[model samples]
Structures are given as structure tokens and as C-alpha cells.
Target: MSKSNDAISQLTEKLPILLIEDDITIRRFVEINLKRSGFQVMAADSGETGLSLMENRRPALVVLDVMLPGIDGYQVCSQIRDRFPEVAVLMLTALSQDLDKVMGFEFGADDYLVKPFNPLELVARIRAILRRFNKDSGSLLCSGSFRCDLRAQQLFMDEREIELTPQEFRLIKVFLEHRGQALSRDDLLNLAWGEDFVGDPKTVDVHVRRLREKIGNAPSTGRIETVWGSGYRWREGS
Candidate 1:
């Protein structure tokens, strides 16, 4: 066998997901659909079981419903963010309120979608999140106690995982790849969101703020410094 082929085999790993929804119908539907789409899924009808699965299973991402019996989604999301910072969370809610969105974001949800959601849309959202995260730098990256697992798309501080949203994960990947250089909001838009994205560049600012909050001093720069007139840069050294 070719050396590269052997190396690839050695590194390949499965990306599993967890779904926490109280409704039996939705849970089975999502679980089956996720499996059909080639993702290994772990399903739970309660937040307690979901948390239990998370501890034992260590899923890479979670599809969580906001409304659930016992320990609601918001609190569960909070707990997940606090305990497993590396696991990505996608919040499912029935409410279309801006307040609901704000609450989810504040509680560390990576993505939020309304109920009666399209199965395909949920699949697509999951794919997008994983795609952003799946970019392996081809080597383990580190600065201080923080380590980046390129293969798994997970960040760890002193071995504890640090959760990051898909956008935030992409942002860090971009920054690390361009370390020592100042990246303007536009540059970030192109790199992180891709040139195809027609959204405003100001959105980059929001994700950056969120990323900084989660990664904290783990960044080589100790902080993502504001570039004043230009944008932001993940400078090396504190």
C-alpha cells in the first residue's frame, strides 16, 4: 500500500451526532434521516438522557429542541456549553421571537432553526456545521495549554474541549492559517463565509465577538486584537 494511503487510513474517524428532542416522532424521524444521510446519530427524548449520552458518547454535534420535558433546552444548552465546550449545538425552537433567537445565541447555540423544520434543511445545516469544522490543518496545532485537533475539529484547553460555533470554528481556522497578519472584515467574509455569501461584512464582527468569548486566552494572541481602521488580527504572543 502507498504510504499516504496507509496514513489516511490511520487518521480517518467517524463524526457522530446527538439529537435531543422530546417528541418521539421527531426524534425517530431525525434519527432515521441522519442515519440515511450517513451520519451516526444518537437520539434522546429527554435532556437528562441527552446529557448522559453526551458524557458517555462524546458526539461532535447536538441537535437540541428548545422545548423539552425536564431541564429545558436552554438550560441544557447552557450546561453543554459549560461542560463540553468542544461539542457544537444546534438549537431547535418553535418560537420565531427575536428574544428566542437572542436567548439561544446567548446560551451558546451554534445554530438556531424554527420548528416544523424541513428534514432536508436540518440535514443541510448539520452538514454545513460539520463542513466548517472538518477542515483539518493536517497537523495538531497548539499554543499554551490549548490544542487544536485537526482531524476531529475540536479545540482543547489543558485537555478540556472548548466548544465553537461553525462560523467561529471557520474563523479560527482562517486566523491560524494566516497568523501574524491582519484580516479585515471583508477578508474574513470571503475566507470564512466564502465569496458566494452575499451577507453584510458586519456579520463577521458578531462571530468574532462570540469566538473570542469562547476561545478566551487559548488564542496565541491571548486575545483577538482590534485593528482599528482595518479589522482584526490574531496576533502571536500575549
Candidate 2:
């Protein structure tokens, strides 16, 4: 097996991948492929069932479909972000429009894939997303008044913990790592969302804005300064 597949297999052994798709055929196809890929799989037919599974199973990642019967994928993704900010969500949909992809990201999906996608590609994407979360597991990333415990996956400002969605946490982690440097949208996207991410650069702006709101304008939050015509920078020092 490839190194990527090896990583996915190891990660999924402990935490199953939750599959939420209303279409029985697609659901089973994905479930079989995932199991073949050496992943632990839990299948759900509806968003409600998926969320319920999330409560108990606490899967490492959710493979969610957008066209569920009740409480569409966006709502499910939003709820996942609100309740389980640590879990990664990958939205599967037939809608191939850019707007739909952006909507998924806005609703807190870690990635989006349209229907008719290759099961192999789906596995690769899952590996990529989970890999991003698992990277940098040993050490703390500290800058200004922010301190991030990499192993614990927690961020604190002024020694107080701050709640963050997975995306937000990744963004801040990138910012703290590259303080005082003007990181362009592409740079931030590649660092935080991974180069495999398919979405708008505006998504970076939205996340940065939200992170700013959560961290506030306090000098300790390490002022996120916008470089005109460029991107953003984390001010050096507290």
C-alpha cells in the first residue's frame, strides 16, 4: 500500500469513518470501498441518523451527502461544526457548481466532492483531510498571547482556552507559525486547508474574519494585519 493509504488505514483502525448518504447504492459502494481500503465504516441513511451516530460513535471524519431526505447536508455539517468542532466533514453532493462547493465550505465542510466521483479519489481526499489533522502532533505552537497545544488540539489566548472549529484552528495554527509574514490567500489555503482543497480563496478571507472575531482585537490575539493587495499577517510579539 502507498504511504497515504497506510496512514489512512492506521487512523481509521481506531476511529471509524461515518458515511451519511440517503442513496442506498452509493452508500453501500462507499462503505465497501472504504472497508476494502482498511477503514472502519459506519453507514447512516439520513442526516438525523448521522448526527445521532456522531453523538455516540464520535467518528474521526464524516462522509456526508448533501441531498438527504431531512435536514440537508449543509445543516448537518453546520451542526457538526457547532457541536463537534474537532471532527472533520467531507460533503458529497451531485451539485457541481462553485457556489455549492463554497456553501459547503462556509457551512464548515473540510472538503467537497461531487457525485460520480471515483471511490479511489474519495479515499485519497479523506486521507488528505485526516492527515492534515494528525500532522504536528508533538509540541506547542506559541505566538504573542496565543498558545496552541498541538497534541491536545487546543488553542488558548491569555492562558484562556478559545473554542475553534477545525478549519479555524488550522488557520490560526498556520498564522501563529508564520507570524509577521504576509501570507497570500493561496499561501494560507495551502498551509491550512491543504493544497488538495478545492474551493474559493474568499474562503480564506471568511475564515480569517471569523478567527479575528473570536480572538478579538486585543494586542494579545496577535493583530491579524491585512497587507493591501496581498493577504494577512500576524503581528510579531504581544
- Candidate 1 Cα outliers beyond 4 Å, as residue runs: 1-14, 140-169, 179-190, 193-207, 214-222, 227-231, 235-238
Most accurate candidate by lDDT: 2
Q: Which stretches of candidate 2 lie over 4 Å from their true place?
A: 1-9, 12-14
Worst 10 residues of 1 by lDDT: 5-14
**Residue range 1-238, candidate 1, lDDT tens digits:** 5985444323322588899999998899989898887788889999999999988889889999999999999999989987887778889999987778777767777677788888988877776666555556577766555567677777777788877755566677778777668989999878886654444455677678788777775544355778999999876655
Least accurate 10 contiguous residues by lDDT in model 2: 5-14
Q: What's the lDDT for candidate 1?
A: 0.77
TM-score of each: 0.70, 0.90
List model 2 lDDT by residue over 50-128, tens digit each: 9998888799899999999989999999999889999999899899887888788778887888889999899888887
lDDT for model 2: 0.86
